[model samples]
Target: MSATTQDAVQHHDHHGPEKGLKRWIFTTNHKDIGTLYLLFALIMLFVGGAMSLVIRAELFQPGLQFVNPDFFNQMTTLHALVMVFGMIMPAFAGFANWMIPLMIGAPDMALPRLNNWSFWLLPFAIIMLAMTLFLPGGAPAAGWTLYPPLVLQTGDAFPFMVFSIHLLGISSIMAAINIIVTILNMRAPGMSLLKMPLFVWSWLITAYLLIAVMPVLAGGVTMLLTDQFFGTSFFQAAGGGDPVLFQHIFWFFGHPEVYIIILPAFGIISHVIPTFSRKPLFGHDSMVFATGSIAFLSFIVWAHHMFTVGMPLAGQLFFMMATMLIAVPTGVKVFNWIATMWKGAITFETPMLFALAFIVQFTFGGFTGLMLAIAPADFQYHDSYFVVAHFHYVLVNGALYGAFAGVFYWLPKMTGHMYNDKLSKIYFWISTFFINVTFFPQHFLGLAGMPRRIPDYATQFTDFNAMSSIGAFGFGLSQLLLVYIVIKTIKGGEKATGEVWEEAQGLEWTVSSPPEYHSFETAPDIK
Candidate 1:
């Protein structure tokens, strides 16, 4: 073995952990924190998923059966809050915590103590928010958007929800700052900015975006609190304040927040697709540029989400056109992925299957988003099941699918055992099929003028709603298999080789399966 390899092996021997539960709780190690973030996200995933199932169940028929309108509204609100803050964002952070050090050949995150604190804050924040449901007036019934007038109408739960959101935002910002500093200042001697893996590059941009926008969300929510209690009228029309401004500010942050979730997913896909195809990524420069362009376009397109809130023709047109322009860069990415797979030595592993599904489903979501960007069409579609369907395609099928892909792809590295391939494929197939069944029909329902957030609907919408609900249950239940696969893999299986996949590349692949607590004590020489 070469001198560098010898040093790395010796370094690994020196810093590896002695396994125990206390090691996880009190540990500041990046890999340990990453596991905590992921396991926490998985638990939140089930919690949020259950909330969604309740919404689907209530919407299953033409009338409310499982829940009252107020309870239904609470479910809708908390479902979004938990999923966005609790599940999706943390999942990405978990990916960063785990992969960033290994990818960049850093021994650990720059500020390890803060990393532990950031993760521990999550469970407490979520508990505080969840406790609001049992408060006298129940949880904040306003949507996760948390507009002023509606939010002000809710009970004491509003303050708790707002504070919880603030806590969540703070946690995210700290995590983002840590990632940015580590990637910027802590990379091993030979790793250049551009030479970093796509996952790191994507995250670098995502962190910057988070730092810029999360404060805006915090400020908006803070104003909402003032409006409710301090007698301020930031969103009250009668008090000479315009509620529309809340949207303006919210979407300013909200639009980029959407990119914040998906961009990392893009990074993961960029990494996985190339590895599985046994080829270099097609248009690597263009992929980076496309990601940057999407982040840029995200800001100007905020108003597209508010098209129905009223704007002058020119303003509406400007926002619509800017939103549509996002398709160019996004399209570039799609074509590049397809081209990468063209005539390549493709393997149908679980990760590759999820990546392939993401390409198709995310593109379908993007197309619908483009159609919604048309202001005239949006007027009809606004607040309907179509809007619900659109985001589920993007968020659930897009972001969530990417998370699953990453988990399956990296399981071997994270745990020292290979997952059961037969069970993995079965989980993927069942999820893909049922996911489509759940969300696809909602598009038709939206077109048929079924309004969202309603506890009841007309009898004509019954058939599709029932079908969608059944599919929701199927999708929800299928996740049990995922839980099983993860547990079984962790328990014990066939040992994984250093290179988990036959054609995997990057600094990460250079390390052993279940990488050492302190990886790359001596950095690899990047060729």
Candidate 2:
């Protein structure tokens, strides 16, 4: 190395993070930025969870019990917005920022300044989104899908909501760009594409997906803005526009956005399952191919979400077959996870427990999706509680559980302290049990002809509704234990070794627990 470059590297390494709030505000360090993303996501999780409890409490036993219908709808809309944009997406980004460079032996993200800008955009967007509740119309009551002309009725807060979404889209796109550049350009010597860790591979594909679709979402919302104010008839039937066109546009982005949410979790599972099972991942190359195949199929399956909208027979058939095709790749993933654990020295640690539950419950979601994919069957199921149940299974059990597993698996490395095993297991079991109790009965409710998004329900739906509300409370309250466990681990715990897990492999394990401020100051040589 040139002496000038060597001296500059030493000078950069000598400084630590600044003290107090400015550190978070102005710092370009990837780990600090990652912490910011994670902490923000954690705060938003509770915020969204609280909105859900309101929805559940109102639905617990009755006809307009705690909240009016409009407010209840607002709760549903805000809950989805907060969870999807504010909580889950950022949490995965946090995992990306903190772990990707470590895993790939880079000093940091390829674009550190842009990374800082990306994270800071999220808070402002979410805050503006939340503030709309106090506006004249309360919040947007048209659901997270924001279908018009219902959404166009939103008073005073309409522009704020649209602009908030714009900011969010911009933020996500910037983060995606940063990830793509870093992964493509910054891998250490000898760390070829196929040799990179699974988590990195997952994020790489997810980043591409993000860049591709986020703009589509932006365009849809921009059209919503124009229709609301500028006398454009892009979606207004009165202005020679078809509202169905909006559905086509939105779902085109929306369906891929689902994969954008889950793929990172798939990556997390790949890492966690292998480590806990004490085996190299089964079918590694096939896993890679399957992930790509699922992504490719996501674009074609968008119409399944709208099968009941009176599509042509050929269109329905094509979409039905395409939606079912997704199961091929997903099934490969499920089989590979089980096979990885087969006859291996499996240990049911907190991470593995979550990963196992993810496989089971996510499969339940997939089966329900298959049921919904049949256009004729979807006629009976569309907008019912069954659809609600299916997605929650995929998102909560699939994506959120994967995030939990990642956190538990990596906390030791992040904090340089081992989390309490007993507390973590308790957290896991409580979450797993109540999550089922919360959503499983919704399937029966849908089958029995109950619709979703209504504040009041028929008396016959009371029992399962009550059960779900109770479970919601149990599940929501149980997450506090996670906060406590993380805090306890951070404040003090058993010291962690460099390789926190027994068979944990990767460049990440080679660094110190909690790692240097500038990890891989000297680029690692891959063998």
Candidate 3:
């Protein structure tokens, strides 16, 4: 290396992370905090994956072979909670911490200390969640919906689960507040809201959603705690309260919570598609507006999840229409992505491949979602494996795939070294292939009348369940390749230049790969 660049790096590291664990504990640096968030998410990814594998294993032959029904329920419940909070949400936040400031030319997050609090809070929350496994009742197994009466039956573990949820909610709200403030106030000169990167725009919408919904979630759970212990009637059917009220509150938070997990993914797709296609994102303004519209519509469509709850026909129709309208904005995004790729110099790089798979699979999930939105049809699909198939399509292939694309798209920039292109591509296709195998059969099973969260099923499902189990193992194990690729790139590889991708756009690509510890020390001119 040139002495000049070596000296420059040394100078940058002077105030950077120190040689021990303390660098992580007391540090306020956005990059360090971002690294911590990413690593934590990785840990949770494995934890959640293990839970899912167990679930698949028990369901393999569907004969009560591996685990009993209650234990099986525990696996399913913790798997959803762990993946949603410990893995997917944090994964997005990790990317946000690492990329947002760079994209918008901010010196650092507006609330760096709060960022640390948010990151640190996650471990404690997840630990509290994990602790439930050892409690008397073996975790809250009434399904992630946590409907009362059943949830109230949870033994000593109930408090732990509720408290864990509250902590995670607190973390999300704080992170949202920080992101909103940083973006609203921190953009470099001339970087207007419209001119900022789509990622920034995506997160802005997500932050608003988080702020709106997380507290409602906390309140709902808190009410559950009071009802369970304090003899309140908030969800007690015999008392003056109603159980459906809990569904209303939870879904109010839950529907937007789904978007909170995905909007950042849309942002990731926007950036990745244009880059690999060697084109600008089509209808950028419309993309931004579409995201906002989806957020607004998310609040109204919560009832789509509750169509089976005997709502009046008028109410059901309203929710069904609102849910369907979400497709308009979502469709705009899909078309814009396709248009961005149309007739362009497209390259099926690893990120592009993942992004493409995400589009296709997530769309399939969306179709099922629309079907479920039909209040009449939902009677047949609700709580069935079809619903399971729809969400995994949306989440694993949709949100998680975007996380994969973002990691690969930015790994070079994050590490100052290019990942092994061939191995990464292999990882991508393996995951893509097996993920389909794992979830696709469930669509048929759902249609054939298999309910979710069951430990055993009829003989007719044996073959498909076996295929799904095999696929689940393959898909779950293949993710470690990502961990390996990331480590290999960091330890040593082809040294990356400032611009990792050839046609990379925005301020992020303008800086050094593995950009200095303190990025944007002096803001760059946006124009």
Which prediction has the highest lDDT against the true structure? 2
Tens digits of per-residue lDDT, candidate 3, 426-493, equal: 99989999999999999988988899999999999899889999999999899889889988998989
Residue 380, model 3, lDDT: 95
Clashing residue pairs in all predictions, respectively, total 0, 0, 0
lDDT of 1 at 24: 82
TM-score list, all predictions: 0.97, 0.98, 0.97
What's the C-alpha lDDT at position 426 in model 2? 96
On TM-score, the leading prediction is 2
Backbone clash pairs in model 3 (N, Cα, C under 3 Å; residues 3+ apart or in different chains), count: 0
Q: Model 1 off-target regions past 4 Å? A: 1-15
Estimate candidate 1's RMSD in Å: 1.7
In candidate 3, the residue pairs with backbone N, CA or C atoms under 3 Å apart (3 or more residues apart, or in different chains) clash, namely none
Better of 1 and 2 by TM-score: 2
Q: Where does model 3 exceed 4 Å of error?
A: 1-14
Off by over 4 Å in 2: 1-12
